[model samples]
Target: MTRMPFKKLALSTAAAGMIFGAALPASAAGYTDVPKESSHHDNIVRANELGIMTGYGDGTFKPNGQLSRGNVVKALGKYVVKHSGLTPEEYVKTYGTASVPNFSDVPNSWADQELVMYSKIVKDMGIFKGSNNRLMAGNLITRDQMAEVLARTFAFRDLPGAPEISDIGGSAYAKSIEILFENGISVANPYHPRATTSRAQLATFLVRSYDKVSKEESVMPASFYSELRKGKVSDAIVQIGSTLTELKKKAGDPEAEYDFEGGIRHVYGKYEYGVPHPVLEEGDPVTTVTYYFDEEPSLEEVMRHMGPVEQTEEEEDPMEYDYLWYHKGDFEVFFEYEWGGDTIDNVTVKSNR
Candidate 1:
C-alpha cells in the first residue's frame, strides 16, 4: 500500500493580535502589587492578561523578584503556546505530547511534570537552552539568557540599524541584545549583560516585543490541505485527475522516475515537487502532489491555513510520529511530523480513488 503521509500545523502571528493589542484599558485586570505608578505596571498587567505570566495565589505579582530558569521557561512557553494559533486545550493535545522529559535535573515524578514539560517545550521550540546538560531550573536567569530567549521566541536577529550596547562587549548576547535595544525593550545606559533578570524586566520585554513578533506580515504557509481538497497544489497547477501530460505541460520534464505503487513515480527535483503514480501504466491520472519544505514549518503556521485538525479521543497520542490527516469525498490531505509535533516534516495530498 502507498504510505499515508501527514503533517503538523504552524503559526500565523495575526491570530495573536490580542497579545499585541492596544494600551491596556483602565479596567484591565491587575495584580495586588502592580500599582499604576510602577514602571512596569502596564506591561505586568498585559502579561498577566495574556496568561504569559501570572501572579501568586495571594494575588500579588512580585515583579521585582528574580526569575528562575523554570519560571522563565514557563513564561516563554506559555506565550509561545498561546500565540501558536491553537486554543490552550487544542495546543496541549497537539503539542503537549511532543515535550520529551529529558532534563537531567528535572525528574519525571508527578511533582516535576509541569516543569519538565515547559522546560522541554522551550528547548524543543528553540526558545531556550540549558547549561551543562542540565535545565538549571532553580538558577536565576541572567540578562544574556533572557536576551537569547526573546531573540529566539520572536525570530529576531541581525537588525541592520540597531544600536550597539558597549557593556555587552564580547558577550554572546551582544548581537541578540540588539533586538532588545532595537525594539526598545530597554534603553538602559550600560546594559548589564550578566545581571539577574527580574519578573518585571521579563514582562517589559514580552510587552515591548508585541510590535515585532505580531507583525501583519506573519501569515500561514500556503494551505496544503485546502489545495489538496481543490485537487491541486499551488506550485504545480495540475489537479489530482490531471494527466501526466498536463503535469509535464505545467511542471516541465521529470528529472527522475522510479516504480511507484504499480506505476512510475516522477520526481522533478530533490524536494517533494510532484508525484503522480499509484497505478500500473505510464499513462495514469496523477495520484498525489507533495510539497517539501527546506525548513521545517511549525504546526501553528500550517494549521491556521490548513484549518481544524481531526479529533481523536486519546488523551495521549501513542503514535511514534504526530499524524494529522483529513478526508474529503475523493481527496485525502495529510501532514506528518517526523521529528516532533511543532515542526512539520512534509505534507502529501492524494486522490482517494
Candidate 2:
C-alpha cells in the first residue's frame, strides 16, 4: 500500500458550487456550529452528527486554535471503538507514562471515559510522546508534526514507493497533511494552498478526515438516490439508464442491464472491464469513463516518469497539482517539477476524497 502525498495540489478555484446536494442542512442537522460558507462547516457538522467530535467549551469550534497532543487524542477518542485490534484500557496501560497514574489528571469517573478513549487511540496510533519519558500530552502540535501523525494514522507510512528524504524539516507529519486538503477538511489556506497550518485548523482537519474515513468506500455518489426519493420519475429513469450504460462497459457485458437498490445500481456482467460494447436496446442511459494505468506503474516509476517535468503557469500550478500524485497510494507522492523558472520544487498531492 503506497501512501502518496494527498494535499499538495493547486486550487481548481471554481466558483462556489451548490452545497452537497445529498446531505442535510448544517444548522438544522445539529452537527456543527460553523456556517455553511466556511470550508469546514459541513465537515464539523458531519463529524458531530456521527459522534466523532464536539465543540469547545465556548459553544464554538475555534477553527484556528493551535492543536495539542492531548486535544488530538480527545478528538480521536470519539471514534476508537473496542475491537479485536486493541481495547481502550489496554492502550492506556501500555502507552501511559509510568510516572503518572492512569487516572492522574483524568478523574476516575464516568465523565473521564473520553480521556481514556483518547489515550488508547493516541497510543495505538503511535503518536503519544513525552519529554524525558513522561507522555507530554499537553504539548502544542506544530504544523509538520501534525502532518506526520496524520499520515501514520491513515497508514500512509511506508508507502510502497515513498521518496527518500533526509528530513521533512521539523515537519515529519507532512505525509498526513494531504488528508486535510483533499476532503476540504480545513481552509487555513483561504487563498493559497501551501500556507502554514495552525492548531485549531488541525483540530477541525482531524475531525473531518476521521468522519470521511468512516463512510462507505470506493463508491462514487449516484444522483439517482436523490432523484428517485424526490419522485422525479423522468429523472430517475434517465439516471437509471445512464448508470446502466456506465456499468455495462465496466462490467464488460454487452447484454447487461441493471436494477436499482440502496442508491446504487446492481449491474451484473460477465466481466468488470475489458469487454465488448453493444448498443442499448434502449437509449444510452449512462455514460462512464474508466481510468486505466498507462502501464503497470509503481511509485518509483511515477516518480521517475514525472521527475523531469516542470510546472507550467499556463497550466495548473504546483499547489493544485500536488494532490493528484498522492491520491493513488501511501507513497506520499511529490512533484519535483520546475515552476516559474525555478529549477526544482516539490509539493504534496491532494485528493477530493
Candidate 3:
C-alpha cells in the first residue's frame, strides 16, 4: 500500500442541496437560536429535520454549546437509523435491548433504556470504547475523540496512509485521525486534536460525512451503463464530443479544476469545486473529466464500477507525465505515480473510434 498524495482542490460553492430531500420544511421546525445567517444554519436545521438532532424544550438549538460524549452517541444512533433504511422500532428490536450493561455510568434502567441501547450499539460496533468500564457519558468530547467516533461510525478505517501527525502518531486514535484527514473531515493541525469541538463544528462534520458516505454508496456500477453507452463513451447527459458547457449544464459545476496542456481538466468528486471551461483545441475536445476519491480507492474498487480494463500500461519518466493507464474501450483511467502507484487519480473519456 502506497501513501496517497494529497491534492488541494476548491470546495463546492453550489447551494446546499437536500441530503435525502427535506424531511420537513425549516420554517415549519424553526429554532430560535439558529439564525438564517449562521454558518452552520443549514446543517443544524437539516440534522434536526431528519430527527438526528433535536432542540431544547424551549425551542432553542444551542449552536455553540459543547456536545458531551453521551449526546454525540445518541445523535449518531439516530443518524444510523435514518440512513440505515430501518425504522426506530425496527432497529431497537433487531439490535435488541441492552440486556447487559457495558458502561458503569449508563445503567440499564427504563429511563436510560434508549441511551443504553445506543451506547451498546456503538460499543458493539467499536465506535465508542469506554475507559475503566466508564464511558464518562457526561464529559465533553475532544476533537480527536470525536474523529475516532465518527470514523468508526462510518467504517473509515481502511484508508490509505496519510502524512505523519507528530502528536497523533503514538495515540490509539492515530488511524482514525488519519482517516479523518484522508476523507477531508479534518486537517492535520498540531493543536486541533486536543481542542474542544463546538456544536457548530460537529454539525459541519456530520453533514460532510453524510455527503461522503452518500456519494460512495450512490456511485453507478459500470454494468449500469450497458444499455446507456451504445458502444460509445456517452451517457444520457453528455457524450465524448460534448462541449464543456454542455457537461457543466448537465452535471452542475465541477468540484475542482486542473490546468493541462491544451485544455483544463475538471473533477467531479467528493472534494473541490470550480467553474472554468476546458479550452477547445483542434484534434480532440481536449477536455477531460476526472473523478477524485475521498479515500484512495484500490484498483479492484475502480474496476468494480468501471468493468474490466481493456488494456494496462505504465508511464515512467520525469519529462513525461508518470502514470498507469487502464483502458476501458471508450475511456482510459489514469493512476498517477506514488510509491506503489496502485490508486487511481483520474479518468479520461474519449471516442474509441
Which structure among the candidates has the greatest TM-score?
A: 1
Tens-place lDDT per residue, model 2, 1-353, is 33342211010112111111112333324434565687666656654444344454445655565556666656444233221123546535543422233434443453656665566444433444434434456676565556555544443223333333333433435444443444444344322223444533553555555544434231211221112112222111132224454544444444433332212223332111111135334333332211222222232223221221222222366443232232222122233333322122322221111
- Give lDDT: candidate 2, residue 18: 18
Best by lDDT: 1
TM-score per candidate: 0.58, 0.38, 0.50
Which ten-residue region of model 1 has the weakest summed lDDT? 1-10
Q: Number of clashing residue pairs in every model? A: 17, 47, 4
User: How are the candidates ranked when ordered by TM-score, highest leading?
Assistant: 1, 3, 2
Q: For residues 1-353, what per-residue lDDT tens digits would candidate 1 score against the true structure? A: 11112121222444443332213322356777778898899888876665445567666777788988887777665555555555545655654434454667776663866666666666655565566668888999889888877766664434347485778886887776776677676777588889999878877887677644444232334444344545566666565677777767777878777875555667765333334445444356777776666676665445434433443122254465665666544776777675334566766677888
Q: What TM-score should be assigned to candidate 1?
A: 0.58
Each prediction's whole-model lDDT (CA): 0.61, 0.37, 0.55
CA lDDT for candidate 1:
0.61
Any runs in candidate 3 off by more than 4 Å, and if so which?
Answer: 1-42, 45-59, 157-171, 188-191, 218-353
Give the runs in model 2 whose Cα sits over 4 Å from its true position: 1-33, 56-59, 82-121, 157-170, 176-200, 215-353
